[model samples]
Each structure stands twice: as C-alpha cells, then as structure tokens.
Target: MFLEVGGNRSTRRKPTVTRENMQTHQRDREMLIWSNPGVEPTTSLLGSQSSNHLATMQSVMYELMSELNDRSEDLERQMLSLEQRVEQLTAGFNALPAHLSATLSAQHAALVHLLRERDSRDYHRAAGGGGASDAGAVVAVVPLSPASPLTHIPSLQLLRYKLPLLRKRPPQCQL
Candidate 1:
C-alpha cells in the first residue's frame, strides 16, 4: 500500500512486523481475554480448571431440578386433598333436602297422631264418656306427651293435662 502524506499519495513500503511486536500483540490479546468476564479463554490455558467449573455447574443444575420436582409433587398432593374436601362438601350439600324432608315427615306423623288422639277423646267426651265422663275423662286426658299441641290448648280443661297418655316419641336423626 502507498503512504498518504499531506493528502497526497506517495510510493513507500509498509513496515514489517518484528518478533517482539508479534509477542507484544499476543500478550495484549491474552490480557484482554482475561480481563473481560464475557470472553472464555482457550482450554490450552488450564484444562483441569475448565473441567472443574463444568462439573460444578452440572451439580448445581441437578440440585435445582430435584428441588423443582419435589415442590411440584407437594403441590399435586395439596390439590388432591383440596379436591377430596370439595367432593365431601358437595355430597353433604346434595343430601340436605332429603334429610330435611325426612325430619319434617317424622314431625308431621307425630302431629297427625296427636290430632287423632284428641279427636277420639273429644268424641268420647261428647258421647258421655261411657256414663262416667267427669273425673275419668280428666284422668284419661292427662297422659299425652308434653310436646303435644293438645297439651298447649287455650282451654280451661285440657291446659293442665300433659300426663294423660304416653304416646310414642317421634324419631330423631343427626344432621
């Protein structure tokens, strides 16, 4: 290549690279590679050290993968438990109306039985209690259940008569 002097091209020779200049350039390149962490040096520098760093990176990656798998399994177990609880709640909710209907049916049966007993007794009283309706009628009307609506009548006679007849108690069930 020609040399440019004062914006004019001149016929001249290019400088030759000496051995010392080549060595200095090599040293500068190596120094640059060492100073910058982004540059990976050649394995010719330290083969054992590079191998050690690779091994350490692999071990750390394995540990992280193992921990991730363990956490994922724990989360799956928790989700399964929550799903089972939800199923139990749904089952209980679905059965609520049936249970309520059964309980109400039992209470209705008891009420009907009480009404029939009261009607029978009133019929008997109207029929003159078989010719002995005064004290005998009072005694007969005293043995009904304490929970009977007949026992809560707003009357002058049957108000104090919760001990006339012992009827069968209604069936009870737990919720």
Candidate 2:
C-alpha cells in the first residue's frame, strides 16, 4: 500500500485556520470542564481555575472588610459617648463635699509623712530645717506586743484572769 503525500479532497494552505481550529478545540474542552464542574482538568486549566477562585475569595474578603469598617464607625461613636459619660461622672466627683475633700487631703498628707519617716529615718532633721543632728531621728513608735490577747495570752492567765472576769464562778472547793 502506497501512502500519498498530498490530499486530493481539499487543497487549502491556510495556517491561520489550523491555529483557529486548535484554539476552538481547546475552548470546547475548557467549556466542558467548566460546565460540568465535577470533572478535573489538566495543569493549565487547573491553574486558571485556581486563579479565578483566588480572585473571588479576595472580592469576598473586601466585602467583609467594608462591612467591618461600618461596624467600627458605630463602635467609635459608642466609645465617644461612653467617654463623655465618664467625663460627666468625673465632674460630679470633683463637686464632692468640702469636708470629704479636706479629709482626703489630710489622709494624703499623713500617708506622705509616714512614707518619708519610713524612708529617711531623719524626721528630726527634717523638722529642724535641714540641720545636721547629733542623734538618729526616731520617727515610728511601734507597739512592743502586737499580738492580741485571744491568740497570745498564757493558759493560766486565760483561766485565772480572763474567764473569771467574763463569767461569775461558784465558790472554790477546798481540796
């Protein structure tokens, strides 16, 4: 059997037609995959589909960000309102009674004096207008026994001194 080089049916030398036909075939195959969506595609087609999916996801993210921006504006307005209410409460606190203000100032001054006495150990020097004193200035006067009678009293003292004082006891039996 001899194979003929030239076809006898059609003698068309159109290169553009062949290219167009190939492009159309590719488009048809892509359309089939796109329409049927369950069918997986080759690498090139998969890449295009992935890029399209990414673009769709990006647009959805933008829409969500826009919605969040609107909510943020409303939250900012609410925060400003809360701040104004706090300012009003602070102004009311500023209008407290003069006695209360005086008490607070006296307590603050006492606290400062105590803290200075604790840190410096020079209360007399401070009172002497920064004079060099011979002795160490004693500031604090702590009690010798800080524990209460309930926890620290001797058992004999508790029975003899405290219990008899609290309740009237019967006459002691002469053993």
- TM-scores of all predicted structures: 0.47, 0.33
Looking at candidate 2, the ten consecutive residues that score lowest on lDDT are: 166-175
Q: Rate the local accuracy (lDDT) of all candidates.
A: 0.57, 0.54
Residue-level lDDT of model 1, residues 55-144, one tens digit each, is 999999999999999999999999999999999999998777666555544554454455455556766877864543232344322333
- Model 2, span 1-175: residue lDDT tens: 2233457553545344466788888998889789768765676678798999999999999999999999999999999999999999988776645445454444434533544443345546477556532221222222222222223334322233333332222233111
Highest TM-score against the true fold, candidate:
1
Stretches off by above 4 angstroms in model 2 are 1-41, 98-175
- Provide the RMSD of all predictions against the true structure, rounded to 1 decimal: 13.2, 21.3
Q: Flag clash pairs in model 1.
A: 142-163, 142-164, 143-163, 143-164, 143-165, 144-164, 144-165
Separate clash counts for every candidate: 7, 0
